[model samples]
Target: MSDDANRHDPAPNLVLGDADGGRLAENIMHFARVLRTAGLPVGPGKVLDAIDAVSQVGVASRRDFYWTLHAVFVNRRDQREVFDQAFHFFWRNPNLLERMMGMLLPAMRGEEAPEDKPELSPRVAEALAGEREPERPQEQEEEEIELDAALSVTDREVLAEKDFEKMTKDELDRARQAIKRMRLPIKPVKTRRYRADPGGRRADLRATLRASARQGGDLIWLKKRSRRRENPPLVVLCDISGSMDRYARMLLHFLHALTNDRDRVHSFLFGTRLTNITRHLRDRDPDAAIDKVTAAVEDWAGGTRIGESLHRFNADWSRRVLSQGPVVLLITDGLDREGAAGLEVEMERLHKSCRRLIWLNPLLRYDGYAPKTAGARAMIPHVDEFRPVHNLDSLAKLADTLSRSESAATGEMVRWKKLAA
Candidate 1:
């Protein structure tokens, strides 16, 4: 064959027996890359696992190969969605590049659905469709099956666009799973006396005297050191109103982590009423604890009655949880649909009862936020510090603030006072 003919022929590089194997291996690698881009955490281990799974299953049929790799690589529920989307787009039999290109158009319009379903561009889709499918009965059946399930395509696209607001029951469940996996670095506050070493410090006089007495009352040197325990009680009041539904659920996971890690973390959730969930959060497993809390809370995603809730907390829970200069985390948006009278009184009481009352508001995530609302106005001055709690970054800041001795007071309170003029 002439050089031109050899170059034009697609099978020139293919060895007779290994032609199919080579193509399957190449496609698997490419599909793995797609899964990685779609946020499936497809690392070298998963890649190796995919290859082994494909080899064991035998690459004779496309459906077997697709499912074999999927069973090995897609572990988590959220990851399964991304993997399924990427797998369909990447392994298309005809007009793959065109389909991918259609997917990319939505992204360019700044309306790309959530990171749940990563789609490709039209140009890219056209490029991928370069290879034609072999005419086989099984291949035709697979194609027909896929076409019948086209409804899933629009569903994924909708999920991507809706973000958190449009999450389905299953998606919300997966989100909660994601939240559980998140690790919050909550350091314990150590007391001054706790740092002293029993052996190196002044001495344990009582122990030394006891030791000398065992020696038949001989003149023996004795040393003594006083010991004080370090236990910084954690007090958390989480808001569970409609406005804080998303944030409150996630925060509950964090609080569960905190409760299990520490000895004295008191947790309470409130919407229309106060419900102490310290015991519930203390359950060893976060999922079980959250389930227990869900069962206990009568007002999940209910109307906000912050004033009323806070008043109840101050009246009943404050004395029990606020002893030992406990650090207070007041998690709320401060958007009391009810009037601020009860909130103001409760805030004042809470501030006095705790060592520091740090207010965490999701509303503060916006840059131009002002405490113009009645609840914000009533509660701002009473809080030792005000901070945002909308995202992971904000939660990290909260961890830092909690670990430290002093609270980082923001000027939003000052801004609010001026605005009230």
Candidate 2:
């Protein structure tokens, strides 16, 4: 429970139906259930709180009533989208329901729906379809295929290609489990610091002198040494703005896995500001770690200020964490609230400070995507690699791609340079 939950009767309550208090409370309780099913953290306590709050506000208007329930149920910013959709569907409005139906029914009818109607999130869609809980999709058994691939198309394969935003509740759970088993292949870089080696090119003159003094003998054996090779420090800068909410949780799982798997990985989450969540991510349990991160970060699913966030990172964190030339993974869609003000300079500075700068943009999943945004254009030219980070396949490919001991592709750089131009 958050501090807000422990407050002295802070105003927020559940209210449903316009008839009577008893019926309104009952319907509101059921609505809370819907929200819980739709991936909200709503519980019995919140329903009670909402009920208590409703008496104070009264059934003034639909807007007031809606807000009263929302305050109690929706604690986190990311949950707002899901809760909003669920509320509209669960309460069952005529015009909105018809629009939702138009958007939902077209696929079954074998035709595309009109673009005018908004589509529902998979979580919201599944929550509303609780006519009966459909059998959870089971993993398909591998079947022999003649196509020269080792594995045929299976649920795992489908999941590998599917966008993180479109996954249902069951699929999301399966995906998280799969991500837990993933390993990011480590790529070590040779540092200037030296360590003792049995057979090496460089002589350890200082060690030999110290050894000779201790032994007090002419028969002094010279020691050999070599530069230490270690996995480069990995620094992740992940965006947590509203535009990125769908991908944020999934990516946090990946970050958590990486942090637990290795050392020297620093993670910072940014939306309107930068937050260092490296310590929180060190927790072994993913859920607990994310909870800690949520508590630490104040700007989750809020407005993006990429330029301002980057500037802050460059000013405050660059020296402390960027030492030893870390490989920086800047994860964002490059949406900036400041419209790219001061972005180019900071990006260039960050690029210079790091050994490699890889920008993982979920927007790259779209085939015809362009750096049309001011922030995207300003930052693109500075990145060593502009890659997609939307699905399991892309993450796996990122692991494989980073593992290779090769320089950045010339054509890739040229293409992005042209795009930025």
Candidate 3:
């Protein structure tokens, strides 16, 4: 291959570091730290590797320097967008740098308000704001008392109600941890099989006779059995389309907790198509699990094909997963890019297959909400429950609803179904 072709090819690896060498090297180290702060997996070894790689390909040409660093740092497809934004901001791209700097300083009275600029990820924004995590010693300082709940009650309450769409970087981090600590308090469903229970109503004649035989028929011992109970299987179909972008990440954390905390839980994320992520979420580490999901899902934050996704689920997955009468959670905003084609039939089929169907919509958080869209109208009538799932309080309420002996749609929600009908 020619030298030019070889120049285009690159190596992988990057790290956070400090430079003792000189100004140029120090700047590069600082840049790598910025990327690390922005949630990239840059490490100490990668930092040394980045420095060595930069030495071979000098920073004379800006384009060459960018690509060299990109080769080392950008490992996954999803990392590209954050890497691009951080590069432009940290390297002082004249346009974005000047614009961002202007905002940091106070606006002069009567200066024309700046037009809304492009959105940056919360992680990127926080990193650029210089919010490095506080350092900790290898050993934590001994405390006489430590509270199980990290935050004060008022602060925790505030965090619980804050909308996921508007939460800051720190708030989001706390929310992710909170979701991991949560337990879905759903009650178990009874099965036809029976297990020995001392207080059971039904007599186990065979067991009683065997016990008496062991006692030489001198005494009769009564044995009892009861229906076996286990947590019902859960099938979660979550929308990851453009409209759901704000809530999807947080909800994914919720799904991950559900998968790890329960057995027979299946998670399917759908954008324009359905993708099973149950296996990925089984990873013990939340960050690693989410990374795998990000790599696997091809249609993140894309268009929605609600009817198409639901149809595929009913046709391919319903019988297999729903045979045990699992409770289904259909989480979406009901904005169908396909205009609700075949949505009603698919929704009805899904509802009938599962023991219970709960439609958890973020939009329902708003007061006086109704099924204004075609897809919502079609789907509302089929679900056994319609509930908002935007905040922690709502999630807690959902747990209570599931733990109850039985539940059905509220009267107000039923009115929506009637109107749609």
Who wins the TM-score comparison?
2
Write down the lDDT of every candidate, Cα atoms only. Answer: 0.67, 0.82, 0.79
RMSD of each: 16.6, 7.4, 8.0
TM-score of each: 0.56, 0.82, 0.74
Worst 10 residues of 2 by lDDT: 2-11
The model with the greatest lDDT is: 2
Descending-TM-score candidate ranking: 2, 3, 1
Which tens-of-lDDT digit does each residue in 50-134 have in candidate 3?
8789889875565676777888987765567677767655664324334444544467312322244345566776666673335
Return whichever of 1 and 2 wins on TM-score. 2
Instruction: Give the per-residue lDDT digits (tens) of candidate 1, residues 285-347.
Output: 887998899889888777789888888887787777787778888899888877776778888
lDDT at position 171, candidate 1: 53
Query: Which stretches of candidate 1 lie above 4 Å from their native place?
Result: 1-205, 226-229, 407-421
Tens digits of lDDT, candidate 2, 22-73: 5778777767777887889887899899888887887655566667788998
Tell me how far the alpha carbon of residue 51 in candidate 3 is from the true structure, in angstroms, after superposition.
Answer: 12
Model 1 global lDDT (CA atoms, 0 to 1)? 0.67
